[model samples]
Each structure stands twice: as C-alpha cells, then as structure tokens.
Target: MAINYSKLFNRRATPQSQAIPGSGQVRNSAGGYSWEVTDWQRLDRFLILGAEGGTYYIGERDLVKQNHDAIIRCIKENGARVVDRIVEISDSGRAPKNDPAIFALALVTTHGDVAAKTKAFANLSKVCRIGTHLFHFAGYVNAMRGWGRGLRNAVGNWYNAQEPRELALQAIKYQQRDGWSHGDLLRLAHPKEVSREHAAIFRWMLSGQDELGERTVKRKVNCAERTATYAAVGELPALIQAFEQAKAAKGKGEILKLITESNLPREAVPTEWLNDAEVWDALLQKMPMTAMIRNLGKMTSVGLLKPMSAAAKLVVAKLSDQTALKRARVHPMAVLIAEKIYAQGRGDKGSLSWSPVQPIIDALDEAFYATFSNVEPCGKPVLLALDVSGSMGMAKIAGSCLSAREASAAMSLITAATEPDYVIVGFSAAANGHGGQWGGGEPGITPVNISPKMRLAEVVKEIEKIPMGGTDCALPMVWARRQKVNVSGFVTYTDSETWAGNIHPSQALRNYRDQFAADAKAVVVGMTSNDFTIADPKDRGMLDVVGFDTTAPAVIADFIRSD
Candidate 1:
C-alpha cells in the first residue's frame, strides 16, 4: 500500500496566534490586525474521501459553541474527567477553535451526529500525524472508542430485554461493531427499506418457521449458503460439520439449526462424538480425516503444534471451534495482584488496581525482557530521568503515566541485580500550581536535580507525589554530565513537549563531553504524543523512544527489553 502523504500534510494550516485569544497582543501572522476573539471559526462542509474521488457528506456545526458546551456537560456527567479542568472553564466559542482537546471532548458527546464525530476525528488524526503528538491522541481515541463499544454492547443487551424505540440506536451500534457498511445497515433497518423478501426472511428466520415448512434446519442451511460469501469451502467447515453432527445424532430438522446456531447450550447435540475428524468428513468429504489427524499428531510430536489441553478443549467446546481458536485468553498475570506499589489518581481505581490486569503485567514482563535484550548491561551507573512537568499531572493522562511508572519500577526491580546501578532524576521546567509544584511559568522548563539511586519504587513514588512541571530536557542532560559519574547509559522518559531552553538536547550531550568531560550516553523514552526529535550525528548511541499505550508497562517494558 502506498503511503498517504496527503494525510500528513492536508491540515487546515490555520495557526492561532500564540497570545491568548482574547489578549490585546494576539496579532495575525500577516502583521497588521490585533484582535480579541472568543471562538474560532467553525468551518462548514466536513468531508471524508471514499474509495472514489469526491468527498462524502459528513456533518455541519450550527454553532461551534453549542457543540462545545454539550461536550463539556456530557463528559462531566459521564465522569470522563481526562481534560475536565480545561474543558470546564472553556468558552464554548473560543475553546472549540483554539483547543483540539476541547474539540475532541465535545465531538464525542454530541447526540445524533455520527458524521460530525467521524469527520472531526479524521481531521484530528490528520493534524497530529505530522509530528509525534499523533500517538498520544491515538491512544486516547482508541481507549475512548473501546469504552464506547462496551457501553453500546451493554445498551444493546438491555434493549433486547425491554423492546423499546429508546433502544433503537443500539441496532446501529451493533452493526457498526460487526463492521457492516454504514449506508447498507442504515437502509436495512429503515422502515421504508423493509421489503416483502426481507419481511418473509425476517418472519421465517425469527419466528422459527417459513411458509414451506422448511423450518429451522433447512432455513439455516440455505441462509449459510447465501451468507457464505466465503471464498473457500475450508472456511467455516466446522459450522458445516456441526450441522451434520446434529443430523447424525438425531434428525436434520429443528435439531440441526439449534445445534449450529450461536449461543445455544451444548447438551442440545452430540458434540462429544463429533470430533474434528468426524466433522471434517461430514463437511468436506474429499478431505481424509484420518490422514489429517495423523499429520496433526506428527506436528504435535515435533513440537510444531501447541496441542489444546483438556481444559482448553472444554473451553473450545462451549463455542464454535473457530471462535475458540481465535479467542485469546487473558494473560495469567492480569488477574493476580502484582507485587508492585500503589498508583495515584486517574480513572476508576477499581480498573487500574493490579488484580484486574495481572495478565498485562506478565505480558509486559515478556515484552520488557525482549526489549531489554538489546541493552548491554554493564557495571556503570544507569541514569533514569523522569518527566514530572505540570502537564504530567495525573489529571491529563488517563492513568497512563501512573501505569508507566509502575511498569518501569517493576522492570527495574527484576533487572537491578544484573543491570547498571540505576539513578533516577525527576525534572520539570514548569512552576508549582494549586494541585502541587510542577515545572514552569514561561513553559518554564525547570529541571529538578535528583542524585541517581537504585531504588526504583521509591523513585516512582516520589515522582507521583510531587507536582510534575515544565519539560525542559536540556537541564537533566547537562546535570548528569556535571556529576562526573561514569554513567554507562541514561534512559529518560518525557512527553517531548518543550519550552525555550538554552541548549538543544544533542548540544547538551556534546556539552557534557566538552564542558564536563563525561562519557554518559542517553536514550529517550517519549511518554507523550509530542515527538522529542533528537538526532545523533556522531552515532554515540540509539535514541529509543515510544508513545504511551494503555498497556505501557508491558509495552514499554518490552521496548526497553528489546533495547
């Protein structure tokens, strides 16, 4: 597939003045007019390109402020307090135009406006793609989308129990989840689109009977054939065999459909007797089941096949074999209480606790090791610089930074014995706020200097407790070199957002050598969406960076382990 360069470049390119919107100094790039404005212009005609050329109709905003206000209220009410502070005080008119954060919050809450939301998201993706900030937004979008899907699923189940038009929105949601075409599904459910053929099929399939007395069994068989847009006969052979299993056990009437259709009890059929061999024979007569079984056995013997254990077999038996094969089990660590320390604010504590995601921790361990394999563990001191800027406030990130701290500590604990003696230094260029002291006042990048130490948990706890501020990175780079400790390697975690600092990051590293006579090398792990673009021309070492993910402990651990 060719790269979509348009996606990278086709932003509105409408840069707002650096001065606050209502400020007198808010001058245009054109260098003439100074204006005080409350809100940004709401562009009409939100469009998305289809497979063909012309843009498809998406949505329009009546007044940008109305949408913004709706979003603020909805998010506050819904308890999605990710950007609540900024959103709560937003001037609906000014906020939408100035802040993508405000725009995203509002877009999600708007009712009966799927097209608008889609367009807004697409635009947001396009704008962020040019720089490193895209990843941060991407993570948030993914989590929000997942949460929405879950909410819709619950609503659907509820509506199914109580048949009401109030739940009618759920049918659309179900179709979306299934990846059905938007236009096709909408038309299908529309009252005018209900035709004689559709009505007959609906009545027959839904009512458990058809006019021809060719009830459940025959109907399903025919329905499967029609739906079988499957390119190959091998696909869904298990389902075909399931029908035969029902027929072989008793009769090929209503019994077969009940057995084959999803969500039915297993006691309804002879599933035990209908093993893979029997099922294969029943569906694809040409395939030799005995030979296949023998080949499977050979594979198992050679360790090429991961044979399903009896417990796994039982689990698979509950669902279609295909579903069982595709379904992933929760990682063993996900359910266990991790031997790690507690995390501070962000999201429902009920979900973030170690017990809910032990499997993720285990996966992180595996990933961390993989990433860590790249690092050469030496005797020198390892410097770990953390970003604790005001933006690093737990309020902004949805438990991401907290999770990262925990995971990093966990990895450090495991590697403490083998790796270099670790020293953690927390720095923020911002000033302290009402919440707590952070980094800066002028995007003020204040770098808090901490002597390097090996205690990872203690380091994490300290960073979490303190107010995280400005992201000036140059300070830490210079500070570490000044200490003249033979630093083997330095790993810095930051959001890559920067204010005007005296030295560029690369220059700071070079300055360390020239000014301080130090050989400490560094790799940066960017925790935010902002791209911390530090290129190493001298090939001193690689700059390892990654964006935040929900499962960062595992993801970053894997990234570090790979290093």
Candidate 2:
C-alpha cells in the first residue's frame, strides 16, 4: 500500500495547546512538542508505542525527560488513586497483552535513572498481569532480548515459581506451540536452570532434528502430550494422529477434549476447523447468540455459507422473541458488530458478500435496535452532545476502522434511543461571517438535534451532514443551559481536546447545574488519547470515562443515580 504523506503530515501538523504552565502552544514539528504532557496522554503513548530513545517523534533526551518527569509527578501526587486508571488505559482492548507488555519492558529498559526506573517498574509490576495468558508470555519473551537477568527475575517473581526450571518449561512450550522465535526463548531459558528433558526437547527443535523441523514436531508432541497425560512416551505418535483426525472431523467429543485437555490455542485452529457443519451445530447448541453473531464475519470469509445462513436464520427467528431480545439487549458487543456489518463495503476484503441475503442485514439491524432495549431507562431527562469537529474526524478508533466521529455518533444514537426524554445534538464551531467560511471572528457554537427514532446508520448519516469545523466542547452544555431545557444529566462524546470556546467544559457544566438542576451530573466520554479532560477532577458531579468500553453506559447510569 502506498503511504498517504498528506494525511500523515496533516495529523502531525495539527496543533494542540496545553493547560499546564511552561508548556506553551506547541506547533507540530519533526520532534518534541512544547506543551506539558498529561499523565493519561504520556501513559497512552507509552502503552501504544513503547519507549523512544531520541529515534522517533518526541524521542529527544530532553523531551523524553520532560515526559517521564510529568508521569512520575502524577504518580507521586496521586499514589494508588491513579492505579485503576493506569490499568484501565493499559487494557484498552486495542491490542492483545503483548503490545502493552512490550511497552512495559521498554519502560524498564529505556526510561529514568536507577531509582526512578525502579519506582516506575514497581508501579508497573503492581498493574502488569504478565504470564496470565499465552500472548502475555509470548510478548514478555519476545521483548526479553539483552535482558536475560531481568527476564529471569521477572519470571521468578511474576510467575511466582520457586525455581527457574518451571518458567523455562513454560517458555519452551509457548515457543514450540505458538511459533514464538526460538532464539529469544533460548536466551531466556537459561540452560543451567532447565530440566534435562525440557532442554533436550528445546535443543532437538532448535537443531532441526527432524525433516518436518522443530515447530511441526513440537506441535504434534505438545498436542499428544497434553492429550495422553497418563499414556507412555511410545504412544505419543498414535495419540497425535488421533487428535488431528478428531480436529478435522470437528467431533464434539474431540473438540471438548482439545479445548479442555490439550488447551489448544484458539488462533492456531484453522478456519476450516470452524467451518465444519458438526462444529457449527455444536457451537449453536452451546454458545449464546451474541457470541455467534460476533463470529459471523469469520464464518462468512471461509465460505461456510450453510452455517452462516443457518445462524442468520436463527438470529432473525429470535428477534421477535422478547425474552431472547431482553437477554441480549444491554450488551454493547452486538451493537458494535452490527455497526461494522452495516458499514462494511463491497471493496472490503473478507467481509460478508456484497449482497448478503436480506435476513442477514435485517438481523444486524434488529440486533442494533435491540441494544436500545438493553439500556435501563434513566427516568430523568438527559441531553447527549456529540462532537462533530474536524479533529474528531482525523483518526479511527485504536483497533477499529470506525473514525472517532462515527464512534461518537454511534454512541450518541445509543444514548438517545435509551432515554425516552432526551435531546441529541451534534456540535461544531459556526462558520465565520466571511462567505460562511470556517475560522476567525468570535466563532459561535452550532448545535443540531438528531431524531432519536432514526436508524443507527441513518443517525450517522445525519451527523455526517453537520459541518465540521473547530471544536468547542463547552458549546453543547452552554446551548442546553441557555435554551433552558432543564435536563437531569448531560453526556458528551468527544475527543476532550476542547480549545475553541472561551469557557471550559467544567465551567459550562457548573453553570448548567446552577441554572437548571444543581444535582444534575455530566459524563464526559473521551474518544481519543489526548491529555485534555473536560471533567473537573474535584467535582463529584462530573465523571470522565474512556469511550468504546462496554461498561461505560452502566457507569454513566450509576453516576447519574448517585447522590
């Protein structure tokens, strides 16, 4: 794919001002911004990109020092108070555990002096749940190069093993089964600590003892070993062949055994394995409809039309069943999957056919509509404000193709649908007087109400129709207060990089509370990883949450109900 220089340049060029002192408005350059970094933003970058030693953007020694200092200051001041936020941000569900683990290792390797690094590592260790899963182990070992001593201590401490031998065995197993690089695994294995049997296996694999080579044999051996726990070594080959045949047949007995006994990695299983009729039938009998819906795209890709079509029929049949709909109503996963399905284009690879049968599309629409039923009706009236600013259109959600603007709209639609007495508005700065051009002159806030009853896709379309300009986050609350709507709560979905308005968002919320319902609360859902936050840290009525988290709606409801 060709690189889009213009888009890359524009993203870097976008200027963001800092509220902190000594960090003036920083224009985008080759490296280093002038603004003071916030803890959230610093940690966000750290988790996403790992440590930079004056190599990438903002990697200069002085700049890195400033970023590190800011983060340390935040930690020292907040202590355990910020621990939950750190864990939450680290587990943002954008990438697997590997990404964050690598970043954590990078922090230990690259940042701060000895004492500072130790403090940072201690803090990270408190939140980092390394070795909890296969990917976590793979990530830690992958990034363990040139840090053998640290790796040894980490495995001992983090894994809570008395001896390094247990850690070596686990590492070798992951390398053999999961296709992790052998060289990295060997470096961490510490030949002195490994048991003779495990060491032999590792050496055999690394030396290419068989024509099929180490990985192939290791996988078969691991599968067989896991399956025949009580069987002797001579029975391994037969056991491996039996396991393979069972997996290919997708027999229920073998499937259960593989999952329970062998603990086969889900990703390692071939798509064809999932395509089997017996497997689909078994899954439908055992798994919930929501889980099936989430995997629909994957099923479609492998041309499992019979199963995919059957699943679609099942979904449609359940749509009219109130009990079934009620069970799936509040879960956001269904809505998320439905939105992606609705947004998928013909050109998109591995997507459902360009013209999928009507029932499949209808099922998606119904699932999305059902999400509204899941929202517990907040008896009190509310106002939802969605930011449709140019900045909001700049980036897609971390792991998804949906842009921030689209996500904001989708979230707004859910809120509007759930609240019976609600007003939904999309806002951006108004055009300047000069031929209705954007920018300059006391720019005013523009807000437009979108119908709550509109379909989600339609709602997004209407939101897109709103003119995109400079962001003024306070405008929506300001508009609600000025209009005297008397809302009981306020919800704004934004990037939280508010700069256009003269008044801050917290101030606007305070003004709205004083003028209307003093007990009213506001929930600011941040859609991007910027440092700026509109919620007042000290205000009990204000709450800041990360967007795309399935639990956010429930959190908002609880906050609104709180005294």
- Give the best candidate by TM-score: 2
Q: Write the per-residue lDDT of candidate 1 for residues 401-433, one digit (tens) a residue.
A: 234333333333333434556665566553321
Residue 226 in candidate 1 has what lDDT?
18
Pull out the clashing pairs in model 2. Answer: 54-59, 330-374
TM-scores of the candidates in the order shown: 0.37, 0.62
Angstrom error of the Cα, residue 342, model 1: value is: 11
How much lDDT does candidate 1 score? 0.33
In the range 1-563, model 2's lDDT, one tens digit per residue, is 99986543442222223232232433322211222235755555444322333221233455456545555554555534334445454544322122443344344434334554444344444444433343344454344334345444543344332233433334333444354434333434333323444444344334422333434432211111111011111222222333344446544567755544443333323455665554554444434455555555554444443425675566557544556654533344345545466346232446345334455655566565554324566678877888887767765554344567877777676666666787777777643211121654223444445664555567667777777876667777777776777888888887665555545566667778777888988888877544446676667888877665555666777677667
For each candidate in the order shown, give its overall lDDT on alpha carbons: 0.33, 0.51
Q: Which prediction has the highest lDDT against the true structure?
A: 2
Candidate 1: worst-modelled 10 consecutive residues by lDDT: 42-51
Off by over 4 Å in 2: 1-98, 105-145, 153-179, 182-187, 190-295, 301-303, 306-309, 313-338, 342-354, 357-378, 431-455, 538-540
RMSD from true fold, candidate 1: 18.4
